[model samples]
Target chain A: MTAEALTTILIAMLGGAIRVSTPFIFVALGETLTEKSGRINLGLEGNLVLGAMVAYAISFHTGSPWLGVLAAGFSGVFLGLMHGSICSLKKVNDIAVGIAMMSFGIGVAFFFGKPYIQPSAPRLESLPLGGWASNPALQQALEINPLFIVGILIAIVMWWALANTRVGLVVRMTGDSEPAARAMGINPIKVRILATAAGGFLAGIGGAFLSLSYPGSWNEGLSSGQGLMAVALVIFARWNPLRCILAALLFGAAGALGPALQSVGISQGYYFFNAAPYILTLFIMVAATGSNSARAAPGELSIAK
Target chain B: MAQAETSFATPPAYDTARIRASIEAVAIPLGALVASAIIFSVFLTLLGKSPLQFFELVWRGGFGSSFSLQNTLQRATPLILTGLAFAIPARIGLVMIGAEGALVIGGFAAAALAIPLVSAEAPVYLTMLLMVLIAMAAGGAWNAIAGWLKHSRGVNETISTLLLTYIAIAIMNFFVEGALRDPASQNKPSTMPIGKDYMVGNIPGTDVHWGLVFGLVLAVALQVLMSRTTFGFAARVTGGNPRAALAQGLPVGTLIVVCSAIAGACAGLAGYFEVAAIHGQANASLVAGYGFTGILVAFLARHNPLMIVPVAIMFGAIEASGGLIQRRMDMPDATALVLQGIIFVVLLASDSLYGRFAIFQPKISTERT
Candidate 1:
C-alpha cells in the first residue's frame, strides 16, 4: 500500500474505532460489572437489539434523542431483571436463561420495531475534535459523540469504586464467595439482581449509541451480535472495568479494519475482514482460557464452572 | 414445612414413585406449554387479534391438508438434523450453538463441489454421496474446533461456537458473493444450481425427499448408540462425572470431540439435503434460522434423540404456518418468533420445578420412613 493509502487507512480506522467502540465500551463495561457480581448475561445481544429499537421508537415519538437513550436503558434493565430473577430461582441455569432472554428480547424488538424501520429519529450530536486538522477527512473522522466520553468516565469511576467503595466490596464479596457474602449479612441474590440491572442499563445506552449516533436507525439486523461479543470482551478484559475500555477500543479497531481497507481501495476479502472482530475474540478466548484453571474468571460464575 | 416433613416421614411405593416420575416428566413440560400458550393468548388479545383464529390458521396452513402436511415434514427434516446437532453436544455438557454455521458452510461446500462434479459428468448417485460426505466433513470439522478448544484450551464452548457461527457465515458469504458466484444468479447472489437431472428426487408416493428418511434413521441410530453401545456408556459416564471418568481412564477429550463431530455431521447433512433436495443451490436462503430453532427443539425434547422427532415436527408446524398467520392476522412474520420466545422462556423457567415434587422423588431412602 502507498504511504497516502496507509495514512487514509490509519485515519479511517482511528475514527471508526472511536465511532464503533462507543457501543462496545458501554457493553463491555456493563458485562464487566455483571461478571464481577458472579453472573454472566449472554443475552445482552438481545438487549442491544431491543434497546436499539426502543431508543429509535422513543426518539421518534418524544422528539428527543436523550429520552430515547434512557428508554433503551430501561428496556435493557427490564430484560436483565427478567434474566436475573429467573436465574435466582433454585435449579435454574443462568446460561440457558440468558439465551432465552436473548431470544425474547430480539423477538419483542422485531415485533414492535417493524413500524419504526422507515421513520427517522433525532440523532446524538458529535463534538468536533479535529477542528485544527487541515484535511476534511481527518476532521470528519475526529467528530466524536459525547456518549463516548461518558462511557470512559463510567469505566474510570467503576475501576476506582470497585477497589475502594463499600458497595463495590459487597458485590466483589458476593462474586468471590457466596458463603463469605452470607456471613457478612449480604443477600447474594439482591446484589446480583441490582448489579445485572445496572449492567443492563449501561448496555441499553450502548444500543442508543448504535441507533442515535452511528447507524442512526432501527432495524432487525441493527446489532449482528455485538451484545454477545461483549460477553467475550469482558473475559478478554479480565473482568476489569478499565481494561474493558481498552478491549472495546481494540474490538472497534478490528471491526473498522474492513471498512478502512475498503476506503483505501483494498476491497479484496472485504467480508472476511468484516469478520475480524469475531476471529479476534475467538482467539482471545482460546488464549485466555487455555489454562486448565480459571485464572481470570470470577470464582462463582457459571462460565468458570 | 410440616407437610414436607410428613411426606419425608412416609415414603411411597417403588412402582408408584416410578409412575409419578414419568408422569412429572410429561406433565411439567405439558404444563409449561399450556402456560406459554395462555401467555401468548394474552399478547394476542392485547393486540386486538383472536387467539382462537390464530390457532385455526396455523392448523390450516400447517396440517389441514396433505400438501401442508408434506411441507411441514419437509421443514421438519432439517430441524431433526439440527436438533440432533444440539442434542449431541448437550449430552456431553457442551453448549455448541454453531450448527447454523455448520449447515450454511456445509451446504455451500456441497454446492461448490457439485459444479466440478456435474461438469465432469459424474454419476448422479456418486456425486450425491460425495456431496453428503463433504458437507458432513466440513460441518464436523467446524464444530470440532469448539469441542477441541473447550477440552484442550478450556475455552467456553458456548461463546466459541457462537463466534464460529458468525465467522462461518462470513466465510460462506465471501465465497458465494465473490469466487463462487454464478453469473446468472443476479440480485440474489447464489452458487450454480446443481442441475435438474442431478437433483435428489421426492419419495415415490409423497412430495417429501429422502432427507426425512435420513433424519429418522439417524435419530434411531443415534438413540441406539447413546443408550446401548459401550461408547455410549463411556460417554454417559464421562458426562455424568468427568473426574470419575478420568480416574477410570476413559478418554474424556476424545468423547467430547467425537460427540461434537457427530453433532456437526448431523447439521451438515441437513445442509446437504437443503442444497440437493430443497434449494438445489447454495445462497442466502440457506441461512434460515433452522439451526437456532433446533436449539428449542433439543431443549424441549430434553436432549433425548427419540423425543427430538416429535418435537422437531411440532416446531416445524409452527414455522410452516408463519406466512398464513401473517396474512390472516395482518401481523408481521415475527409473531411466530414472539410465541417461540415465550415458549423458550417458560420451558427454561419450568426447569426449576424438577425435584420439587415429592411424587417424583426416588424411593431409595424411604426404607427408614
Candidate 2:
C-alpha cells in the first residue's frame, strides 16, 4: 500500500474506532458493572436493539434527541429489571434468562419498530477536535460525537467508584463471596437487580448513540450482536471499567478495519475483514479463560466457574 | 442367584411412579403453552384484534387443510434437524448456539460440492450422498471447535459458539459473493443451481420432500440411541456429574466433542436438505432464522429427542402461518416472532413451577401410610 493509502486507512480506522466504539464502551462498562455484581446480562444485545428503536421513535415524536436517549435508557432498564427479577427466582438460571430476555427484547422491538423504520430522527451532535489540522480528511475524521466523551467519563467515574465507594465495595463483596456478603447484611438479589438495571441503562444510552449519532436511524438490523460482543469485551478487559474503554476501542478498530481498508481501495476479503471483531473476541475468550489466566475472573461468576 | 434376582426385580409401585413422573413432565409444558396462549390473547385484545379469529387463522393456515399440513411439514423438516442440533449437545451440558453457522456452512459446502459433481456428470444419488457427507463434516468441524476449546482451553462454549456463528456467516458471504457466485443469479447472488434432474424428489403421495422423512427417522433413531444405549448412559452420567464421570475413567472430553459433532451433523443435514429440496441453491436465503427457532423448540421439548418432533411441528405451524396472519390481521410479519418470544419467556419462567405441584409428584412409600 502507498504512503497516502496507509495514512488514509489509519486515519479512517482511527475515526471508525471512535465512532464505532462509543456503543461498545457504554455496553462494556455496563456489562463490567453487572459482572462485578456476580451476574451476566447476555440480553444486552436485545436491550441495545430495543433501545435503538425506542430512542429513534421517541426522538421523532418528542423532537429531542436527549429525551430519546433517556427513553432508550429507561427502556433498557425495564428489560433489565425483568431479566434480573426473573433470574432472582429460585432454580432460574441467569444465562438462560438472558437469552429469553434477548428474544423478548428483539421481538418487542421488531413489532413496535416497524413504523419508525422510515421516519427521520434528530441526531446527536459531534465535536470537531481536529479543527487546527490543515487536512480536511483529518478534520472530518476527528469529528467525534459527544456520547463517546460521555462514555469515557462514565468509565473513569465507574472505575473510581468501584474501588473507593461504599456501594461499589458492597457490590464487589457480593460478587466475590455471597456468604460473606450475606454475613454483612447485604441482600445479593437486590444488589444484583439494581446493578443489572443500571447496566441496562448504560447499554440503552449506547443504543441511543447508534441510532442518534453514527448510523442515525432505526432499523431491525441496527445492532449485529454488539450487545453480545460486549460481554466478551468485559472478560477481555478483566472486569475493570477503565480497561473496558480500551478493550471497546480495540474491538471498534477491529470492526472498522473492513471499511477502512475498503476506503483505501483494498476490497479483497472484505467480508473476512468484517468478521475481525468476532474472531478477535473468540481468541480473547480462549486466551483469557485459559488455565493460566483464570485467576483474573470474578470469584462468584458463573463463567468463571 | 435366583433369590437375589427376584429381590432386585422391579417393584409394583415402580410402574406407577414412572407413569406419574412422565405425566407431570408433559403437564408442566402443556400448562405453559396454555398460559402463553392466554397471555397472547390479551395482547391481541389490546390491539383491537380478535384472539379467536387470530387463532382460527393460525389453524387454518398451518394445519387445517392438506395443503397447510404439507407446508407445515416442509417447514418442520429443518426445525427437527436444528432442534436435534441443540438437543444433542445440550445432553452433554454444552450450550452450543452456533447451529445456524453450521447450517449455513453445511449448506454452502453441499452446494459447492454439487458444482463439481454436476460438471463431471456424476450420478445424482452419488453426488447427493457426497454432498451430505461433506456438509456434515464441515458442520461437525465447525461446532467441534467450540467443544475442543471449551474442554482444552476453558473457553466458555456459549460465547465461542456464538462467535463461530458470525465467522461462519462471513465465510459463507465471502464465498457466495465472490468465488462461488453464479453469474446468472444477479440480484440474489446465489450459487449455481443443482439442476432439475439432481434435485431431491418429494416423498410418495405428498408434496413434502424426503427431508421430512429423514428428520422423522433421525429423531426416532436419536431417541433410541439416547435412551437405550451405553453411549447414551455414559453421556447422561457425564452430563449429570462430570467429576463422577471423570473419576469413573470415562473420557468426558471425547464425549463432549463427539456429541457436539453429532449435533453439527444434524444441523448440516438440514442445510443439505434446504439446498437440495427447498431452495435448490445456496445463498443468503439459507440464513433464515430456522437455526435460532430450533433453540426455542429444543428448549420447549426439554431437549428430549422424541419430544422435538411435536415441538418442531408446533413451531413450524406457527411460522407457516406468519404470512397469513399478516394478510388477514394486518399485523406485521413479526407477529409470529413476538408470540414465539412470549412463549419462550413464559415457558422458561414456568420451569420454576416444576416439583411445586403435588399432583405431579410420585407417592413416597413412607408418605403413603
Q: In terms of TM-score, which candidate is strongest?
A: 2
Cα error of candidate 2 at position B191, Å:
2.0
Task: Tell me the tens digit of each residue's lDDT in model 1 across A196-287.
Answer: 99999999899999999988788777886789888888877888899898988898898889899999788788889878888988887876
What's the distance in Å from true for residue B55, model 1?
Answer: 1.9
Model 2 is docked with a DockQ of 0.77
User: Taking the tens digit of each residue's C-alpha lDDT, what string does model 2 give over B1-369?
Assistant: 445534745674576568777887789889989999999999999999999999999899899899999999999999999999999988878877888999998999999999989989899889989998999999999999999998888888888888888899899888888898899999998999999888889998999999998899999999988889988888989888889999999999999999989999899999999999989999999889788889889989999998999999988898888889999899998888889888988888888887787766655522442
Model 1 CA deviation exceeding 4 Å by range: A290-293, B1-19, B364-369
Ten contiguous residues minimizing lDDT sum, candidate 2 chain A: A289-298
Local distance difference test values of all predictions, in order: 0.89, 0.88
Return the top candidate by DockQ: 2
Q: Give one digit per residue, the lDDT tens place, for model 2 in A77-183.
A: 99989888888877776777788888888898999999999989888889999999997888998999999999999999999999999999998998889999999
DockQ of each candidate relative to the true complex: 0.74, 0.77
Candidate 1 Cα lDDT to native: 0.89
Candidate 2 displacement at residue A99 in angstroms: 1.4
